[model samples]
Target: MTQTLEVTQAAEVTQAAEVTQAVERPLQTAKPALGRGLLLLMSVATGLSVAGNYFAQPLLDLMGRELRLSTTMAALIVTAAQVGYALGLMLLVPLGDLVERRRLAVSLFGATAAFLVLTALAPNGSILLLGTALTALTSVAAQVVVPYAVTLAAPEQRGRVVGTVMTGLLLGALLARTASGALSELGGWRTVYWVNAVLMIVVAVLLRRHLPKLHTPAGLRYPALLRSTFALFRTEPLLRWRAGIAALSLASFNVLWTAVTFLLAGTYGWSEGAIGLFGLVGVAGALSTLAAGRLADRGFVQWLTGAGTALLALSWLAVGAGGASMWWLIGGVLVLNVAQSSLLNANQNVIYALRPEIRNRLNSAFMTAFFAGGATGSALTSIVWVSAGWTGVSVLGGSLATGTFVLWVLERVRTHA
Candidate 1:
């Protein structure tokens, strides 16, 4: 009886060891990573963040005229937001890995909400500019949150995941002008900010409870993190040149739209309400971001990016020809926005493929160039418009698009070589 009891105990221990080994083997096996929930959350957050950044675009003319700002000075308000966003990407996004992201996200949302209120209440242009910058800086919530989503996805699925989230981002950027214009018509520009303030707060609350815990590497010193970001620029030649293409393309995009407000209102006598309706049309093109993203996932980054850049050049030419012809202008606007969205998504999707471990830092480097190009575009647009006119603006816009095409060709050659 004693020998039989000992034999049963030994068999039970052996079975338990087999079960443990089975569990460990599956963990080690390669499997497809799925992260749709993380993508959904990122999309929602990104949409909200983009909406906040662009509420001022369509209303710039109205606000500037009402506030007694010079054209260039008024333009600065928009540029300031871009500058602030760039700063946030550089300094704060890297903190995603170093800090508790959920807490940081909530705090930034609250801070941005407060600043929007400040923007609504500001008495003068300078105060309004400062408030706008603060609001944009707060919108970096997307930058932090999106890259975290990329980390959760499988390496193979990163492009699709990033593209899916960016669809929300593109929608937000395109819709913001429409929402702002329609809201401003009903209750003035201040009302637009007021409404978004509440929306952001709600998004913050949802994220706080629902976001999954993410892992960040431990023991990364500040200098090390900074060095990693810098290294991307130095070592990643594709990232470097791709970013330049993105910058040039973005510059032309901003130049056209920033100057269009004045031309549409002053030259064509178009109402803000009418202009806002055009943004709705642009949504058709904006929706293509999903397709662009999926294509990037299929290893067609160079082709998608190259085609998108060519589209940008054509759209600019169309807009230049159609100046003041409402239908022509509207058609060009739709094409331009669509092509730009595709190009932007293509760049982002390709970058996501390169860096999984340092997504935040990589994103910061990419977006910094994106916004910096936007800032440079906005700043130079007024000068070009004043010196030459809508036609001149079109020339510059088209030429920049052409430059992006050259950059794309360079990227492809380098990649194949």
Candidate 2:
């Protein structure tokens, strides 16, 4: 009886050991190293994904004229896009953790393509608004691709990777206005959406073929995952601070972009092509992403944030003078782009470092707040542009930037304290 009991205990222990090893093997294995080709693809795809939302910025006037809508009604298209993007960031981005990223991204791209076509064919303001909102909502695929890129990158190289990918995103955003303007000149505003819908389809196929499959079990159900995302803001001061900074920074950014179209078209009497070409001035700022990322990797994140916020506040001075001189507007746009990009990169680096396992959730929390500010700014800028004109818009943007700087100072003091 004693011998039989001993044999039974030994068998049970051996079986437990086997089960432990099986569970641990996958955890211990390292992911394949990310390649430059794949990285570039992701960067391009991210840019393309986000470009859909901004196509209306430069074309708002043309759209308004053709659709027989008022300026306020046309501006609401921008607001709707931002609001939809914010909601998507809050809702869909968290699914990256729960689902396979490639499928989620590819599905979003396809859906965006479909909606862009809908937007192109819309006969009236109501349909256009619906299509634009749905298109922007699905465009959060860019947000998903961002964290997915971070996951593929090595820990030491994460900052550079983020910068490279973000550069693509920024370019897509700034350049979309240029493309829309040029395309509108060539064909019309509707042509811009048709072309982009095709581009989205092409990119979706490329991503489906090239993006490696990665699935990390989040172990929580949908509702719990969402609850956990919001809970992060309450528990993590870093997340809260970063999220606040993101909101203010984006608010300032949207304030400028939302109103600048009106300024250029009405005051300067610029052609759509010329206004589109103006977006190129901000290309220099987009180029700052790589340097900002490298700097963040080297531990200059806080300094980058401080400089960016200060520069953002000062850029409004140039922008205020833009109503009088094109040169001032150009300089203001350049500085504003650089400042916004640097601030955004630094904030992302900070939050991404906080909880590697829950990056999607962190991103959802941060970007939701970020785009909420953008939506608010776009909405207010339309009202401000009507009520107070260029000076009012500048004050609003500058005040938001200044507020961000103050928050950064407070964060710095708290850290030291």
Candidate 3:
């Protein structure tokens, strides 16, 4: 009887050990934590890379003059870049899983740097468009780095790290406008691209030397990998829900920014410089990104989503009313900025949790949808502003915000039920 009891106890202990290892193996295989300095480097690299797409936005008029193109033709410079970026997001970002991410990202940086210089050297409008397209396509380098940040983090801290990197991306985009405007005014529009090219070179060197080479497990062939993205969307209910929220929230945010320029200039008689400066004010709100991440780390996604959607909706009230007062406008803009960052953090928190191995594809799908929303909102703003005027545009933006709030409510009710 004693011998039988000892054998049973040994079996039970062995079973427990196997269970523990099963639970721990995934975490153990995840990439190790990145140091603070390297994380910061990743953030900086991401920011500079994304900024490549926006450099031409404020320089269109100057380029038009130099290239002997009409205003309509010059505007396509920004459009071409944006289209290339969207294509790269879908086509290239997924490659992160199939290759050494640091190698891929650095090579893109070098390629984009060359394209930026090519853009600056272009003698005609056709060449200029070609260079711009190529530059923005490769600038998706930043998107690849995002999943690299996630893979470097522990499962528990993934949200926090993602937030930090996103904050850098947002800030860089905001500053890009301001810096481009200032530089184009002081030097020439071409100077902006040249300076950005040099920065890209520096980032490439830094990444090659300092960024860790994260291991890539064997992956599906490129075509199968691309096809799998669609399968993920079909299967992942949470991905669908989070993606819908991202699209709606981003649309609301873009509607406000796009239409507000018309309001500031027409209603308030603000100068172009003063209007450009509003991008700086939006920076104050981007600070919410890190806080949003921490909230996600603490498992407050649903609550954050509910509250963020509400805040975004309410901010439109101030936005709609701000036709009367500049202070009201500024307050609404700040709230709008904070709410967007929070909602973005919340959405990313959910999607990043869904699949660890396919993170790049997940981010690509989410970001691509998010960009579509922005494009739709931009198009809508043009029509709404022209047809309905200020009141009409505000109502449209407010509707988009309210739609998000409604989506959150439905999600909560469904979960509880």
Candidate 4:
């Protein structure tokens, strides 16, 4: 009886060792190196996720006419979307550190798809505004995907990876206007949302299948996670400076985008399709993202910021001239797009370097400030457009650009000192 008992005990110990090895195997294996194909998929997903917020830009006029909204209310739709996005940056994005990133991203993408349908089916202006806000709020999945991509890349290549993904994001944002206008022309403004809703679902499925699983539990609970995100602004001066610059750059960007539809549709007498096609002009700016990323990787970030800010200020001059000459406006837009893209890439490169472990939190803080500036610009433009017309809008955009330049100068002085 004693011999039999000893054999059984030995067999049980052997099974336990096998179970331990099974658990340890995955932890010991290295993750596959990030590939160009996977990187492109991420970029495409990022772009499509952000596109929903922008679809309304070109469709504002048609939406207003159909919904019987005043000009101010029509413009507020843009503000609502920006505000919602800001909220998401603060509230939802930080959760990336607390949960499985792939699941967080996929869930947000699916939610955005549902919200797009809600926006498309709105029966009145109020519903439309709500839907737009919800859609924008969830569309921050784009931001989540960005840090996820960064986490997968080697430290040496983080800047280039960010730039590549950002290129897709910028394209989605710029092209949404074009797609909205063309789709609206073919069907109606509602069609733009419906079509995008479908696209969101498709991207969600792709992301679910391909996004490698990564869960780095930030150890902090939900409330602490949020507190730490806010704390980053206080502790990291570089984050503060970059966040401020991000705000002003995006504000200037939105100031043009929000009011330009009014300028083009009313002043130039352009059709929806024509105004949409004009967004293609900014595609040239998106192309600069990859090059800017490469430059940042090489340690030319400060020079990039200075040059970009100066170019931004100069672009407004051309944008102001666009009031009479389309050629001047086109030139201005090209410069503005390049400046904005380059500055954004530089800002992110520095911040991402500061804290690799909490990139999502860093991104949240920076983007919240960024979109808040966008919201402010959209709101200010609506008011300025009413009182001073296109000239007022031009002055607003130029002032914001100048402020950004001045801020960059201050940053240089302070850092060098």
Candidate 2 Cα misplacement greater than 4 A, ranges: 1-33, 60-75, 123-125
Which regions of candidate 3 are displaced past 4 Å?
1-30
lDDT string, candidate 3, 4-60, tens digits: 999999999999787566534543654564878888988888888888788887678
- Total clashes for model 1: 0
What is the C-alpha local distance difference test score of candidate 3? Answer: 0.85
| Error of model 2, residue 413, in angstroms | 1.5
Compared with the true structure, what per-residue lDDT tens digits does model 2 show for residues 148-234?
A: 888877777778989999999999998888788778878999999999999999999988998877666577899999999999989
Number of the candidate with higher lDDT, 1 or 2:
2
Ranking by TM-score: 3, 2, 4, 1
lDDT of 1 by residue, 1-417 (tens): 999999999999998787555433432331233346656766977887878788887788889877888898788887788878887888778777566666777788888888989999878899999999998887898888777666666655666777788778778887888888888989988999999888888888877767655545424787677777867899888789878998998898988778887777778887877766655776776678777777877888777888899999999877987676777777888888888888988888777667555667788888888878877887788899999999889998999889999998887788789
2 or 4, greater by lDDT:
2
> Where is model 2 poorest over a 10-residue stretch in terms of lDDT?
22-31
Provide backbone clash counts, one per model.
0, 0, 0, 0
Name model 4 segments beyond 4 Å from true: 1-31, 61-76
Better of 1 and 4 by TM-score: 4
TM-score of each: 0.84, 0.88, 0.91, 0.87
Query: Highest lDDT: which candidate?
Result: 2
Ranking under lDDT, best-scoring first? 2, 4, 3, 1
Please report, in order, the local distance difference test score of every candidate based on alpha carbons.
Answer: 0.79, 0.89, 0.85, 0.88
Best by TM-score: 3
* Candidate 3 local lDDT, residue 297: 88
RMSD (CA, Å), each prediction: 8.2, 4.6, 5.1, 7.6
Better of 1 and 3 by lDDT: 3
